[model samples]
Target: SCHPECNGICAQNMDSTSCTDPQTQYCSPYEYNSTSQSCNFEPTCVDNCDLCYNTIECQDCSPGYYLTPSKLCSETCPTGYYPNGEVCEKCHSDCSECTGPSDSDCTACVDPKRTPVSGICECSEGYFENSGV
Candidate 1:
């Protein structure tokens, strides 16, 4: 038997008998409760998730978040940060952004004290360009 509104039921006429398809039904994000028989959404995934199968298991993430290799949604891994498997890590002290963990790997510098000369940041005016320092 389906609900009175028939919102979650698909009725098919065959040989004078009506058949209801259970798989055709869909539930909203807030109404996906596994224990409930009705098409209702339950809060299963982590916070800021657009879609998830259960608590702590995210299928899709909301905006400003990135889906990691482990399937977890993270907001910390922005443009200048690196994923250290669990969280976003800061690059070198001289770098505003970097490809690795060294000063030579810097993509850009914080400026004034250090300026980006090529791909790396060098000491600007009033400071000597020291290498291997």
Candidate 2:
């Protein structure tokens, strides 16, 4: 019997159910358990992780955290980090997103009220910006 929630096809085994596509690795909010050889229904991600597989291994992270190339979730990225499609990246101090590490390399401001000024962004007149908001 195949799983009802599986997006792709699922193969039913005498011991358990497994997803046929290895590349997709999807099982409708669940992962195939090789240990018991079944589809795991319980959640088992580390702190700050929203989706997990292989027990403690994270497939997706909570907000403010990003999934790394190594499959770990981190609040910040390693040096020389660049965007890799919803992956972790370190932006310039004054930028939400940037082309380079320098403050003047900012491509966008973190705050909507602020405008880019000489590579950095600051609040326009009559507006104030604060950090760690």
Considering every candidate listed, which one attains the maximal TM-score?
Answer: 2
lDDT of 2 by residue, 1-133 (tens): 2243443245652212564644434444465565664666766666777876445566788888877766678876654354555585666767876766677766678777887787687787788856766
Per-model root-mean-square deviation over C-alphas: 12.2, 12.1
Clashes of 1: 8
C-alpha RMSD of candidate 1: 12.2
- TM per candidate: 0.37, 0.40
The candidate 1 region of ten consecutive residues with least summed lDDT is: 10-19
For this target, which candidate reaches the highest lDDT against the unseen true structure? 2
Mind giving the per-residue lDDT tens digits that candidate 1 earns over 1-133? 2232332443421111332544555443433333455655455567778875445556577777766545578876665656564445667787887766677777778665887666579887789855776
CA displacement after TM-score superposition, residue 124 of candidate 1 (Å): 24
